[model samples]
Target: MFRLNVTTLCAIKWDCVIVDEAHRLKNEKSQLYKACYQIKTRRRYGLTGTIMQNKYIELFNVFDWAAPGCLGPREHFLEYYGEPLKQGQRISAPERFVRIAEERKQHLVKVLGRHLLRRTKQETIGHLMRGKADNVVFCKMSDLQIQAYRRLLRSPDFQLLISKDLPCTCGSHLTRVECCHRTAPDGVIWSYLHRENPDGCECCPLCIVLPCLIKLQQVSNHLELIKPSSKDDPEKQKKDEQFASAALGEDAVLVGGLQQDESFMGMSDAQHCGKMRALEKLLETWLSKADKVLLFSCSVKMLDILDRFLVRKAYSFCRLDGSTPMGVRQTLVDSFNNSPSKQVFLISTRAGGLGLNLVSANRVVIFDPNWNPAQDLQAQDRSFRYGQRRHVTVYRLLAAGSIEELVYSRQIYKQQLFNIGVNGTSEKRYFEGVQDSKLYKGELFGISNLFRDLLETVFTSEIIENHEERLTGIHRTSSEQCAKQGLLGEHAVSSKLEIEDDIENSELSALSQEQDGIEDEIESPNDTQSCSESQYEHILKDAGVLYAHRNEEVVNLGGAVQKHKRPKTKEQICSMNDPKTLIPSFVVDEHQRLATPSTLKILSENGQEDDTVGQKRKYEEIFKLEEMDETTKWFLSGSSLCPTQSIDCCKAVFK
Candidate 1:
């Protein structure tokens, strides 16, 4: 119901929490069980038919939620009820488990009986359906799928098993390449090592080499068509033959070459597509009417099928899978809640079962059930939480009478175990005493085959039975039908009207612009050219150029001028080198300028003529100088004996 939706459920703050098929919460260590236990509620109720299918510790999860201290610590509980065994054998605690189950059940009732409520479908809702949901089982695989699988199995390299340290039955120390079954040559091994050597010696050749080889072979086979053929031309024939020989030299090389060319592009394996399409169609029909839906399956592959359908329908949906990034989960939930256009939310139980609030949907559908009832319930609770206002309808789609049924039956029986506990019995005795026939009868049977069979039934019931009346409503030809209905004429008239409107608008704009002289201005070349030139110059300046020109101008003044005469010769210029002529008269009279007025007056008052006095003084000084030795006289002489002057003077006078 809408009131039971997850949002409302969480909002109402119920005093008790009831989880149907409670065995799913058996693992106390599981995230979902832990989440349930953490819920702040006064009472917790779990309804299941089978509780502990695999191990006694599975009950710890339920007990931990219903009564935290009743089960004791995991270590203490295991020590009391768990069994230990040597390697290569399974360990169980059947004898000690039965006793514990009985004691725990009583304790559970005493503590939580007032709030706990549970009933089987047979006791409550049995009359709703005839017997049980029918299931069909089919083992169908296309040739391509089989071939692919066989190729994988035949590969000597088990890359995944080797690289992941996965369990392997093959007992060989030799590398995949060194194995006798391996076709790669020693040289090829070296090449692979050189190109893509393992990080460490710990690598298993099966994991690395085998997968690579298989992928390469697949690629090569796919690309074979594109490979140049010898038969295409005589010139290429020789090359092709040589290449063929080289390729055939070793099995590994051949395989590698084939794989390298294999083309997965634009190619779909028909079987996978067909199966996927079938699933999609089924989903499309169901979703057409269903406001909210939940699809569950043990394998993520089934979810992929639904994903393709959602994509084809252009339906906005969110996917929760093992590989989904953790950060995006809450964002996706918020988007789904806020957006009504979003239709489907694909969730993987392992990743999304616990701690997720998906109360928007009122309907929950299980694509398939696994061995754990708790997992199925958790998936259903995604939509069946508090806020669900409508009556929640849960659809458990099963393949009747298949291994799926076996898993389902086991889940139910296990839930019952939790409901009824063992009392002081050995673990082995507890399991040995279980009624296998009763347990197996409850499993979901033939679900896969049932769907396959239902395809025909659906088509007949939904389409073929009413085909005649539907066909009579329309003409045979699609075009004729449209025309007869007047749809074609309406479409044509609409298109013509749109074109006419566009043309009229264009004419009106031209006329208005012409009247305003806008059109004439637009058509004028001078205005356009001037605008363009200005724009061009502006662009150039913006591009960091101070000046930009398209042409160069030259101005010439042509005239001849007369040559000037040479300057006077250096001899002529030096002829006037006389000291008296060279020295200014003021410089010669510099001493006279420095004399005092009294000194000049004394010379005048003494009646000494200026020239005679100067001559007498000069002669006396010369006589005094001559009285000394010749060397001293020469040193004191005012004039030199050698009186040679410039040749220029001699030349000028002689000439």
Candidate 2:
């Protein structure tokens, strides 16, 4: 563990070397494995529960590490035992497969059993009941998420990655949207390290493809991790801004007491994520019984999101991630096990999966799936390992048909592959897909397994900030509405404040403009002369929606449905527009028929969504967005009628 220099390491090893968790030494190419291979020892022991995680090649490497030439060279091992074992896993005919596997089993045990010993609890004891329960709960992706996923596949920019029509610019606009309904602010570099490799040369495809693919992966799990990056055209942006700004104004309601507003408890970002929703349901059930739960995710971003959620839900939780210092991991683990109040332990899969004792918790939710089945098992074993008294139930939440499903499938293959080498059993199910099929190449992309490379570059951190601002109400309260309420007109609201609020909405115009075929053509107010009754009904309905549940039957008295006392501060205004009452962005976009080309393409491809994908939003997409003058939002005329230059009233000194 000291200086990694070979001379320093070779000098000390004279008698014997024991490698704990010896499966790690399965890779002969790794520097650590190579270093351990160098230490001179007459007698050595390598201890591991799983040696050949994926291929028999690793088994050969480990045998070589412990004893030179024990299994011969890697090539020799592959020819004699590895190829036969692998072929046995792929054999389709059951009778023939099992017969060959039986023959190979005898040969493998005889050859390796001399230096290796593996025994299950049942093998050692006559009969032993298992203490671990594994449950896989399939989750469905939101329609918006599924649409974004399809868009990533077909977007001309993405489909033509290196083409002249679509240069691999820093901004992977079309692809990142697949990861979340939101993504980090634009212009922010996702990674400086990805700009170059260890050799300092520009990374091939990695610089472009990896990040966008990761963004999509994030979308598959939870949108809260990455802010949505899709931008609307300027015109669409202005209209949506007007809607969000005027709809809520400064009357947004902020619920200070989390418990006081039980209705809003479910309104948090947790529901937007399928895994989070499932997790909350699981936690509520377990925590109700006072049982502890360990929740693990590979994404620290997701962990942070969960942390915020648990705190909001008022559940006691402890978290450990890559950012968490190694020195404090044990302390946190102890705190969880020792404290009766800590019911949830949020853990990072890579760090928390290695070797941890978490027997105090009996319920586990693997927040996301992992490609490596062994790592997930290690993470789960934290509770079900040894000291666990209660029967541990581990729930692996996977998006039903999404990439998470594929990853879990791959994990099973790796696991079955491992079993073949150790137990010589071809227990693989027929529909599990081929092991080592490698790339999930799409004919549409003109590429082989690009998605695999994308998935391989494990995501580290995703930008996360509370996007509560964008979730503000869509009822845009205009200057006229302000005047009707005897409130300060839109003029009183500072232009800078208005601009900041519309920062995200600004991009809405760009996206909306791009989808010209879809954008609703606004008709002039004069075009609606004949349909007076219908227009009146529309106005009345709009007014009714504007104020919410107030009585619309006004009698020119102190009461009016849309009437409200003006808010004092922006925060209170936003808080007043209870997020609970706010429309889901997807619903609004749908109602307005503001779907982009990508969304339309996905919809057409899918044709009709099944009931399982859930019902389409009932609120019709807006047929038309009233065109407002460009200067109407930012400035006001100097006329007395106008609420400009802080003028309280217009006495009209004319004539």
Candidate 3:
């Protein structure tokens, strides 16, 4: 009917066609794009809150519709402009390429700036809103979920997904896809069923990349998502049963198992999920405080799980997802806002991420993250936007050291790219690649990293401090301050800070000769500070919180809420700005145990150490490192090596 109406609509020869939410026209190959293009019009205009979400190519598609050929051919634009900008943004990119990338970025901005009319949310709606706090809550997986996750990684299906792109071990110099794994031993092509495929066939021996990822993601959310739905075919159901049984035990095949039984007094099904357990605690606190909550998940199945949990807990809530009727969504939103009894609004991220005014709910919990950062951002805006009176707090619950971390990492990567492209902002190049890949692997992209377990203990204070600096825009303290803090300890505490200030000159002059070249390296803009394993202090109070930090509150001036620079105490600065300085001298000496021989020599000359035997042992370790393979050395180097550099270094040396 839309096709027929579209033809009649086009015949009218409209004078103008204005498109709202114009980013939808990003895919020129889409039917909607083609249909919209058929309309006869002399003047074309488009409006969108987000013109470019994940890539520069999206901007090309939007511009192509508004003013055809303004940005030139897609292939030409991508090659000459997009690719260079992306390459330049890489952490491992050479200094020369970074210059070229900046040049390309400036040129593209010039071209787009002519037709683009941009206004940020801060500019438009800043006056109407209060300060918002964003918090990332990392939830530890349940014992069952952890075992199931590890087991799934070793499954044949997952192994095949990862192995297909690897250089064949047979030394064929061809990828497994091009060589042995191309066809099965039975001469049948290897492929898994598409997640949306209605007519299920016999389970294939091999798995597709996307389906395998969905399975992994499901395990992180709730094991119930991995289980076959009731609508699935019997064959598919049987295969899913076997798959779950193989990863988990046969007892896990019953979804929530005996948790439904009133007689069963063990942990509830909701408690079995790490995210749900966190949500349970949060909801208890928030509801008791009379604070409304908006819960969002990318999966409707996850929403269903939440719905059951809410019902079992006897909490009043409203739900909106893809299954909800278009007309009814607004009604649900209005009811949630007007009725104080509706303490929770269960929303699917994709379905309710946009065009919803959920300001009544001051607390938002993102149960799962989306690959696209914009979706998550939009969801946050539902509560944090204009007319929100109460201070909004957003909790992004993620499984600790799991696929969710990788997903969140990619979100930050894309967000940096977006900021660099649209806002003309400079960002720290923390990743090796701009895009995640299935065919190739890097620090941020790889099946091996995704599958491997990350020790909560391995990350250093520098990692947290760097992250805090990026998010909160606070300057870090100098190494001199760090050394002073270490030496002074609690003895330096004084009501009047003038005493500490008075000692600054003497401290600097006395340490000038001793610190020499180390100060320059420590102060380098691109260089991130490194600490030894013993200096790896726990940043989060709870092991479940893989990482947690909050942005400072914005100052309300007139009606606008904007961030203001404020004075901070020594403790606040150490905790928020330079976490590494909190490490004591003992930890530093322990780190010195792994120092290079040059450092050992300097330490002896400075009379900082008298243990010559330990120094000798440290010097021998350097020789041992030289003898070890590059891969082994990378493992030993730990946080000292830049992840971007290691990818290239390991690839060249190993193969």
Best-fitting candidate, scored by TM-score: 3
Q: List model 3 lDDT by residue over 1-655, tens digit each.
A: 5566897888887789899899888888888888888888988899988887777788889998888889999999988888778877675577688879877876777687777878766557655555565666667787788888887776766666556678987899898866665433211112234344433234432445566677789889987776656677876666666666666775573445512222222223675577887687667766876888999999977887788788878899999999999999999999999998999999999999999999998789999999888899899999988788766668888887678877877776777677667655445555665564443345566655555555242221133333323322211132235446554334222211322333343235324522321111011122122222122112222234444422111100111111122212333222221222222333332222222122222222211222432322332233233344544443423323433344346556764
RMSD of each: 51.5, 30.4, 16.9
Q: How far is 82's C-alpha from truth in model 2 (Å)?
A: 2.5
Candidate 2 similarity to native, TM-score: 0.55
Question: Which window of ten consecutive residues has the lowest lDDT sum in model 3?
Answer: 552-561
lDDT of 3: 0.60
TM-score, predicted candidate 3 vs. hidden true structure:
0.68
Q: Give the per-residue lDDT digits (tens) of candidate 1, residues 273-335.
A: 223333344345445654655555555645654565566567777888888888988998888
The estimated TM-scores of all candidates read 0.34, 0.55, 0.68
- Write down the lDDT that model 2 would get: 0.49
Clashes of 1: 88
Better of 2 and 3 by TM-score: 3
Candidate 1: which stretches are off by over 4 Å?
1-54, 60-270, 273-278, 296-306, 322-331, 362-371, 389-409, 422-655
Lowest-lDDT window of 10 residues in candidate 1? 551-560
Point out where model 3 deviates above 4 Å.
1-4, 183-207, 250-268, 436-441, 446-543, 550-655
